[model samples]
Target: MTISPDVAAVSTSRSQRARHYVMTRPTFFTVAYAINPWMDTTTPVDVERAVAQWETLRATYSTLGHTVDLVDPVPGLPDMVYAANAGLIINGTAIVARFKHAERDGESVAYATWMDRRGHAPVSTFHVNEGQGDLLVVGSMILAGTGFRTDPRAHAEVAALTGMPVISLELVDPRFYHLDTALAVLDDTTIAYYPPAFTDRARAQLQQLFPDAIEVSSTDAYVLGLNAVSDGKHVVHPAQATGFAEQLYHAGFHPIGVDLSELLKGGGSVKCCTLEVFS
Candidate 1:
């Protein structure tokens, strides 16, 4: 595949931009119920370790010259720690998530309250949408995932709200329920993804859109390595995803590994716990 000049420039220069992020402390993190394949209710959780790991992720963001904001954790909402599902904040508008499952439905209100208090114009949608979990911003387009968590109808809502062209991608694997789980946006033009997780049409779309994108191995994809947060230059991903880390380095981007294994039991990692707030 011929790499575009813009993508080549991004690889060569490795330019970075400061980001504003919202993170929730894993104060109530645990696997009490099974919502995804990574969650096993029978497996015991280490709450203390989860909190420590979350703190480290937060500190890492601060160390990277990015601003970090915190939202108070709700007691019964264990999955609230995955703050990225709360809402999609972009272009000065916050489209709060309406979760598909009842288990996480309450999170929408909590996140909306936080966004409202912070002066972000919070908009509510009747359709089911898991915020950044299913919607990822890539340059001027929004890549939306469906067939698992978020509803296809929400794709139109996102386009209407943000005024950005949305490309709908169908997720076939149960494990990679969210778009973030199977794909990571490395920068405005670059992406890293696992092809098997998507439908044939979605895979074709990705290949057409990002010809120079990195195709990660299943080994790294299972570890939620594609659930990474990138700041144009630096990619923050799971420590267990060693192969993905090496790929990022070879692609001319710096990859920082962070251990969020404790939270991984709940089926989330770096990007899952972190939500980028575009003001």
Candidate 2:
């Protein structure tokens, strides 16, 4: 069939738009339940509010033109809501975590099952690792956390699994148990972090690696500001992190804050609830 010049131009325009949409869309994983801290069982959780906040986060991602996926939340396992702790995804392969604490050990199997069902080859880890909670992908390198929830030996396991270079950064403070609690990757070369969370050596490594990283304030870090997610453009952070949001805006990023205070009682906020699904 011979098409007219105008018709061909319109067809080309549609094809270009289709490609743009496919290229820009991002995929993420989430869970329905709120992960309450085992140490603080008495801490009250408004299940209704937590669910509403999670739904809002999902809606926000959907509105921003992204794919949001889910994993079933087990009744007894409260920490399952922090889906990022389940596994690390690289090149669409899942390296499922082996939890150090028995309380969250069952989560590994649940996430592994989901990964298998989702068409990703799920590989179980022999060493203790808390998935993305302790692993942050920056550029071509993986910044892994140690001296806290995740074990140092897991770095080698991750490197072996993904065939990517892993840099082990030790965490010192108990408050920032996971790497996600104190750091966020804004882009390939840039990151936002709270210095106090890392040990002296880890802080130096971060400075050397990311010279232009934004240093978040203690006040903001206390509210889990660094536990934010960015699409190399817009950043989703805690609503009360206004100062950090301004800094993000100055750094050529659009910051969107969604309140997750109810979930904070469980020692998590935004990033913990969202897991990146590698394509």
Candidate 3:
């Protein structure tokens, strides 16, 4: 029995796509050069120092032999969430997000420009919803956090855009600003998150998705800088969370913690410094 040419080609394409794990890594990270986000601390001096960390982080990734792309900025808006805002690498194209926050409204220009200049074609743009803040791209499904930076309508839009079901996680607490802040997908069957941080239902949903989630303490969460890396498996949190560090070790990730007192003062953790561009 001979398979059709289209069937063989499609089978190989599916295999190749599955092997490509979509994760964002920052090469260019700036700490709001246009704003005083340091919160009166002299540690970083200015946003330049924070951006310097990106340079260092890139060098580290280079050692690991992972080729990363650092995206340029959209002019005017200072606190544009490069990691949290726009451009999700779902299937093969970058689906630009419609951010919920007005301050970050114009943030897409820079992303669009980068995609254009680099020949990174975006599949499409959404005028209906917000950006990556609402998304949590796991093994297969896309989990979306509603009532925060992402909208309910946007959730439906992402589902149609990515051709993957977008699961909704309501933002019960404003403090856990993004979906990632409260939870993370460590692997297809494992997770790393604090219990109290997630709602009863959200926690239940996480448990359903990843049953072997490594529960983290509130204190551990703060110290580990759990809010940074988009991919939980490849995390770079603060070194302070000893317990979480051990948990990460068992999970098979080499943790890189930084002196984040300066970065934390402005309410950003490890994930903020890195904005991932998926190919």
Give me the candidate number with maximum TM-score.
1
* Candidate 1 segments whose C-alpha is farther than 4 A from its true place: 1-12
lDDT by residue for model 1 (108-168), tens: 8899999999999799777899999999999889999998999999999999999999999
The local distance difference test score of each candidate is 0.93, 0.77, 0.56
lDDT of 3 by residue, 1-279 (tens): 354576445334321111222223332233443222233334343455555554555555455455556555544554542445565765566777566555556666666666567665655545445455557666778878765566677777778877888888776655666666666555444557776665788778877877777788877765534564524335556656667766665555545655544445545555554445543
lDDT, candidate 2, 89-199, per-residue tens: 778668888998787788788788878887777897778999888998887999999887888988998998898999999988778889999999887778999998888
| Global Cα RMSD, each model | 3.4, 9.1, 9.2
Arranged by TM-score, best first = 1, 2, 3
TM-score of every candidate: 0.96, 0.86, 0.75
Order of quality (lDDT): 1, 2, 3
> Which stretches of model 3 miss by more than 4 angstroms?
1-45, 123-130, 230-234, 277-279
Model 2, total clashes:
1
Candidate 1: pairs in clash: none
